[model samples]
Structure formats: C-alpha cells, structure tokens
Target chain A: MKADTRSGTGDPMDGFDTTIHAPNRLRICALLDTAGEAEFAVVQEQLDVSASVLSKHVTVLMEAGYVEQRKAVRNTRQRVWLRLTPGGRQAYQAHLAALRAIVGP
Target chain B: METDEAIRPTPQQARATLAELERVQASTAALSATPWPRWFATVLTLYIAAIPPVYGGMTASTQWLLPKSAWSTVLVLATAGYLALFAFAAATWRKKTGVALRLDVLPKRATLPLAIGLPALLIGAVVAFRSTGQPAWLFAASGIGAAVSIAFHRAFVRLHRKTA
Candidate 1:
C-alpha cells in the first residue's frame, strides 16, 4: 500500500506512526485510552497475554513516551499502574482516525 | 519468479486491524462500565426514597401511629445506615473497577440527556411542592428521583451493550 502523502496533522493517514502500529501496542493504547489508568495485572488479564509479552509491549510504548507508569501500595502489596499520557492519547486517536481514513471516511 | 516478501498492510489489512481495535475498545468500554455505578445508583435511590418520610415531618395522624421520639430515632438510624452503604458501595466500585470510573468513555449523547433530565426532574419536584401545599408531594419527588437514577443507570448500561 502506498503511504498517504498528506501529513498526519492534516490527514490522519499521513500520520500513521510505526511505533504505535504493532498489534499489542495498539491494543494497549486502545485499552488505556478508555480506562484512563489500569493496574498491570488487570491489563494483562484483559489482554489475555502473558506478563512478559505485556511488559515488552509496554516497554516499547514507554520508550516512545506514549505510555506512563505509577506505583502504589494496595492491600500491603506494591502494584504498578499504567496509563496513556496526553501525547499518547492523541497519537492513538490519530492512528484510529488514520485507520478509518484508510478504511473509507 | 521471486516475490517481494517484506510484510506490509494492504487497505484490507488496515480495515481488519481497525475492526479489531474497535472490537477491543467496545469490550473495554463494557468492562469499564462495571456494576459499581449501577449499585451506587441503586443505593442512592433507596437513600432518596428515605428523604420524604424522614424530613418532611409526618402528618399529625401519621405521627400518632408511632411515638415521635422512636420515629425520629429510627429515621436517624436508617439515614445513617443508607449513607454508610453508599460509602461502602462507592469504595467497592472504585476498587472493583480497577481505576477511577471514567464516564467520559460514555458518549456525550448518553450523558447529555441525564445531565439535563435529572435537574429538570428535581426542579419539577420543587414546583410541585410549591404549587400544592401538601408535604406529601415530597414522596412523589423522591420516587421520581429514584426512578430517574435507575433509568439513567440502565440507559448507560444498555448503551454500552448496544455499542459493543
């Protein structure tokens, strides 16, 4: 498929970012965009993916500055929470719009 | 003949990926809706139902059915219990949902009606109370409040299911 030349800013197809195009990463962003924040175990459970697989995808998103993590103590146990940053949300939404554009308006 | 082997998405592949994303998002929304908010609304409806009987001050004949002191005590305890239940429900909701609840995921079309309709119902309650000098009018208000809360909750759940 030919890459659309219209810039991602003006035309969503133009903004197709490679970093967020991976299947797991896309799923992570989609979930985070809706949940706002979710515990690591919860995300893994929902995705039905192994913790290692989730961790790898999360690392990729985090490296791209699209995802953020926080730590909290719950029930006397330390837990990690994940959420999309504002930038990540924008990127993910744009990617969705780009997908729609490709699919047909 | 050799074929180009580098993996790339065709428009059909892009469309399929988009559909899968939509399916995942829909599932996320369904899971995100949780039951906590509905439970909270149910308890709130009960609390609202208690308001008229407790606060409107019983009629003279009605007061004669139970000693005023005992009646007031029961009302106070019931009110306290309802409030405690609300707090418990809210906390459980927060924990069970795995995050702070996000009503923002609900379509604006779904929320806009609730935002407008609830206050409208309350205002109508006030109008009814003012127009008719009957304190019993409050019971109707409480009933409507409870019903509306439940309806709004159901509407949200239904919308989530339909969209999903």
Candidate 2:
C-alpha cells in the first residue's frame, strides 16, 4: 500500500483529501456542514437519492475520515445519525472558502 | 468597582452571528428528518383550512373594486389558477428538494400540528357562523383534499428517495 497515506500524514485531512470531489459528495458535505448533524432519513429525503447510493457515498466519506456514523434505536425504530469529524469540517470549510474566493468579484 | 468594563455586542458582530444562526436554522429546516407522511398531513391540514377565510376576506373586501359578478369570476378563476400553479410548483419542488413540501419548508417539525389542524378547520366554521350561506362544507372538503394530497406526497417522497 502507498503508506496508507491517511494514517501517514499528520494533517487533519490527509486521508480525506481529494483532487476531484464529486458533486454528490460535495452536496453531502455542504448539507452536513450547515446542519452539524443529521439523520440518514432526513439526508436521504433532502438529497432525493436512493438509500444505497447515499450509503455508498457516505461510506466513501467515512473511509476518507470525513464522516462519522452511528446506529441506535429511537422510539423503537432503528435510526442512523451522522456528523462530520473535525478534520472533515475543516476541510469542507476551507475548500468552500477557496471556492468562494475563486468566484469572488 | 461600579465603573467596570462594558460588555457589549458590537452591531456588526451581532449581525454576523445572527446571520449564521439564520443560515443554520434554514439548513435544518431544509433537512428536517421527521417522516414526510405525518408532516404532509399536518401541514396540508393547517394551510388548507387556514387559507380560504383569508381569501374570502380578500374577495369580500375587493368586491367594490369591480362589479360583483365580474369580480367574483375573476377572483375565483385567479385563485384556482394560482392553486393549480402552486400545486404544480409544490410537486416540482418536492422533486427538486427530495422531501415533501411541508417537511422541506419547516424547522423541527412535530405531529402536534395535526391536533391544532382541527382548530384551523373551524376557522371556516367561525366564518360560516358569521357569514350567511357560506359553504361550510368547503372547509371540510379542503381538509379532505389535504389528506388526499398526503397520499400523493408520500408517493413522491418515496419515489424520490428511491431514485435519488
């Protein structure tokens, strides 16, 4: 393996770094960034994506250390909650700031 | 001791913090996680019941704005066209936002509104008691239409969720 770059780099976002973040991932990050934390159901509902598709994208983000997911029973129903890690938040905010700067007048 | 430091919220800082809070609230509203079905029922009940009396008041107030027949015709047609356009818009918005219209529009939704929804139904009742020959059943019908819309809404939510 290429030094498991995620573990090797001490940078907050070393593992989660991406040169070409896809639209869906970016959308997820934007939604998560603003919401702080959210339920899988709600996220799926807003994004209008299939559960499997969302799960796949979320898994990629999780693998990249950009997300955290937890499972629990709420009101006798199984629910999944998600929040971004500090590294995830930092990366998203900086990336967003950079994008805004790029589009600045 | 009394001449202590002044703790003040600078206008610019207060505005920035308020702006951030409003943004967070809006985002949470967009992503409200409550089941769309219940949200649908509650919202449709409240608004369908609430809107007609206001429209009627507007219609009555504006009666002298034109002749009765012409005015009523224009008003009814305008409102109907607007409602249809609104329904179309809501459906399209449901597609775009990936949630039921009601759920997509509110912050921290709950089912308590359905009980309150009944009172909203009686707004037309109160209007009927005040006005002569008002079609009180119109209110009932409105409530029924709202419930029916919930069915369509749930389907859209489920379908959108599947396709998204």
Candidate 3:
C-alpha cells in the first residue's frame, strides 16, 4: 500500500489503514458500507468474483476486526451475512476521505 | 502476481476508484427503488388521506346508533389497522431491499418537504372546516395533498434514475 507522505495538507492520513487499501478489499468495504449488511452470495454476485476469492478477502477483513459474519438458515439452507463493524465503518469513511484528499481539489 | 501492494493508485487512478465506488453505491441504492415501496407509499398516503373522514364518519354516523365507548373502540381499531399496515410494509421493505429503512432514498427525498408542508396544509384545512362547517373541503384538500405527494415521489425517482 502507498503510504500518504504528503506533509503539508494534514488531511488525517493516519486513518487510512493499509489493510483496506487493496482494490478488491476497498470495493468490498464500499459495498458493505452502503448496504449496511448483505448476504455473502449477494456480495459475491455483485462483485462478480469466485466464492474462494471473495472468502479470501472477507477473511482478511474478518482478521482485521473490520468485518463480522453471521450464519442463518434461509429456506433450509445455511446463508452467511456479512456486515462492517462500527470500527470498520469509521475506518472506511476515513479511507474514502483520504482518497479524496489524495485526488485533491 | 500483482499483489495489492504492487497496485497503488496514482491520483488519476484514485479518482477512478472513487468514481467506481460512487457507482457501486448508486447501484445498491437503485436496487432499493423497486416498485413495491412506491405502491405501498401511495396506498399509505391515500390511507392517511382517508383517516379524518373515516374517524369523523364513525362518530357522526354512530352518534345515536351506538355507545360512545364503542366509537372509541372502533376508532382505536382503525388506527391500529393503519399502524399494522405501516409496520408490515416497512418490514417487508427491509427484507426486499436488503437495506435498512433509513437508507430509503425516495422516502427521504419526499419526506422533508412533505413534513414541512403537510402539517401546514392539514392544519389550514382543519381551520377552514371548523370555521365553515364544511367537511368535504378537508377531504378534498387531503386527497389533493396525497396525490401531489405521490406525483412528487415519482418525479424524484424518475429524475434520480436519469441522473444515476
């Protein structure tokens, strides 16, 4: 991940965690942030990624305490729902702000 | 393999990323714009439009025919029915939209102006009815208000989707 080293603007780059800087990870965060929570399959379908690939990114997010998962039985089938933690939401918002800052006025 | 660390975005790339993110958000929002809610909102508006007359008719028509307590019970039941419908519609909406009720953009857009204008218009109608003893005017005003609100909602969705 590229560190924000621009010294003068002081746009709070500290909130931009490297964990969420990945392109796919950033997209996942963006989706969850807006949807609030979504079924795992729904997220995968929306992102158009393989199950394994989605799981890998989700695992990274889970490890970082940025995401949580719940399992439920829907139509007699187990379904996983994914949502961002409050901390995750804060971090994502801050990261978007950092991105905006990087893009500049 | 190009890992995330190897794929840092330049300023232009960052702009593209943000644009994509915004597009994603917009698409998610659009998913929630299904017709069920629109129809429900229209019905709810019409239901609200009917409330005054329904309650007034219950009391007026039943004044000599039934006990006062019975009137209260019927009014309570009618009000409860409306509340139950609202709750059912809201719950169904949450399920179908896969987003919380607060994130409902159409209602949010329609509500702000409606919230401000609705009370004033309703109160004005009430004042007019009380002073003039004409009940039809109140129903006419509320019915028109409800229709306008539905029209405004459709217009907002149409414009919003066009922009999106």
Candidate 4:
C-alpha cells in the first residue's frame, strides 16, 4: 500500500488518491460518504457484490486507513458497520476534486 | 513497468467515473428518502406535544389537573414509550432501505438550532407555566412543538428528494 500524501494545497493531481481509485473502492467510499455509517451487509447489497469480494475491498481501504469498521450486535446477530475516517473523507473529496478537474466543466 | 501516463485516467475515463459516482449518489439518496412510518410521525408529533403539559403537571405546586404521582407515571411512561418507538423506527428504516437513520446527514445549520431550540422552547414553557400557574402556556407550547415536529419531518423529506 502506498502512502496517501494528499497535500490539501497544490495541483488537483496531488490529491488524487490511488488507494481509492479502484471502481469498487470508489463506490464504497461514495456510499459511506453519503450515508455516514452503513452495515457491512447493507454495503454489500448496495454494491451487488459477494461478501468476500466486498470484504476484500473493505480490507484494502481499511489497510489504507481510509475506512473503519464497528462491530455490534443487532437483532441477535453480530453486525459490522463501516464508515470513512476523517482522513478518508478528505481523501475521497480530494479524489473527487481531481476527477472533476480532469473532466472539466 | 506502468508509467504515470498509463496509470492516470484519461479525461474521458475520468468523465465516465464521475458519471458513475453520480449514479451511486443518486441511488443512495433515493434509498435514504424512504418515508418514515406513518405511526412514527404521528407518535413523534404527539410526544412533542405532550412534553410541555407533562412537565408542567409534574412541577406544578398545586395539583393543577392530575396528582403529582400520576404526573410522574405519565412522564416515565411517555419517555419510555417514545424511546422504544424511536428505536423501532430506526431499526425498521435500516432494514427497509439498507441505510441507517443518521442525524449527521441533516444540514448542521438547521439541525443544530432545532436541537437546541426545541428543548429550550419546551422547557421554557414549563418554567413559565410553573411560575405563572397558567395552563395556557403549556397548551401553547404544545401546539408549537407539534407544529415544529411536523414541519421538520416535511423538511427532511424535501431535502432527501432534492438531494436525490
């Protein structure tokens, strides 16, 4: 995993985060960014991906320090909830900015 | 070896990625906009409306309407019932939409004021009623609280639609 050195200043490309650029990871960030915190199963359903596949992407994001998970019991079952860390949120936003810059108006 | 040029997305690819992001956002927004259960709104409104009178009765020096003992029971029951209902609503909403109910999603500017103001308004009414021995203050506050509750619910729904 590469270090995410997204300096808030400088060219938009400086903020482009490779860790979050993968399509599945990008979609996960978008959903968590909007929803705040989502159950792991919920996220898997939204992405229409297998649990193992979603878990793999989530592990990559977690290793990058872009996402965190919470474990809790709900309805007599253990559940995992995922949310973006503040650093993660900042990187995601910056990545979006970089994408917009590339796309232009 | 993959060069920087090979790694970075071209403008066309960026555009497509952005479009996909927009689609994800739209779908998530739509899911989040799932309407609150009708009973949830009605019960919440009634709970808000009941607060002032219940507190007023609890604090009244003279037994204004109900005995102090009864007021205590009402207070306990109402609070417990409202909390249970709130938990049920949140759980059901999550089950239905795959999105958790989140206060942080609400605009902070609007939510902060309501968070502070609603309690202040309701408690203030109780205090005023206590000092003056007037039930009218309680009734007035109840009406205002109920109206505010309804208005906030509608605003939340509107916000979800607009975001979607």
> Which candidate has the highest TM-score of all?
4
True contacts kept of each: 0.54, 0.03, 0.39, 0.56
> Candidate 3 lDDT, tens digit per residue, A1-105?
233443335544555567888778888898888777877887887788999999999999999889999887766988788899998887887777767766876
TM-score winner, 3 or 4: 4
lDDT of 4 at A19: 83
Candidate 4: which pairs clash?
Answer: none
**Taking the tens digit of each residue's C-alpha lDDT, what string does model 2 give over A33-92?**
666666788788666799999999999889878899877665598878777888888666
Clashes of each: 1, 3, 0, 0
Order the numbered candidates by TM-score, best leading.
Answer: 4, 3, 1, 2
B1-164 per-residue lDDT for model 2 (tens digits): 01111332234543443344445445555443333445435555455544554444444433433465764565576667657766766554443443334532222233345446545554555456346535454455466646645744565455445433
Q: After superposition, how far is residue A34 of candidate 3 from its true place, in Å?
A: 2.0
Provide chain B TM-scores across all predictions: 0.61, 0.31, 0.70, 0.87
Ordering by lDDT: 4, 1, 3, 2
Cα RMSD to the true fold for all candidates: 6.5, 17.1, 5.1, 4.5
Q: Which runs in model 1 stand beyond 4 Å of their true positions? A: A1-9, B1-8, B37-39, B50-87, B105-110, B155-164
Q: On residues B88-154, what C-alpha lDDT tens digit does candidate 4 reach at each position? A: 8988888666676766656788889989999999999999998999899999999999999898888
Model 4 clashing-pair count: 0
Q: Would you estimate the TM-scores of all the predictions?
A: 0.75, 0.36, 0.77, 0.78
Candidate 4: TM-score, chain B only: 0.87
DockQ (0 to 1) for model 1? 0.42
List the global CA lDDT of all models.
0.72, 0.54, 0.71, 0.84
For candidate 2 chain B, which ten residues in a row score worst on lDDT?
B1-10
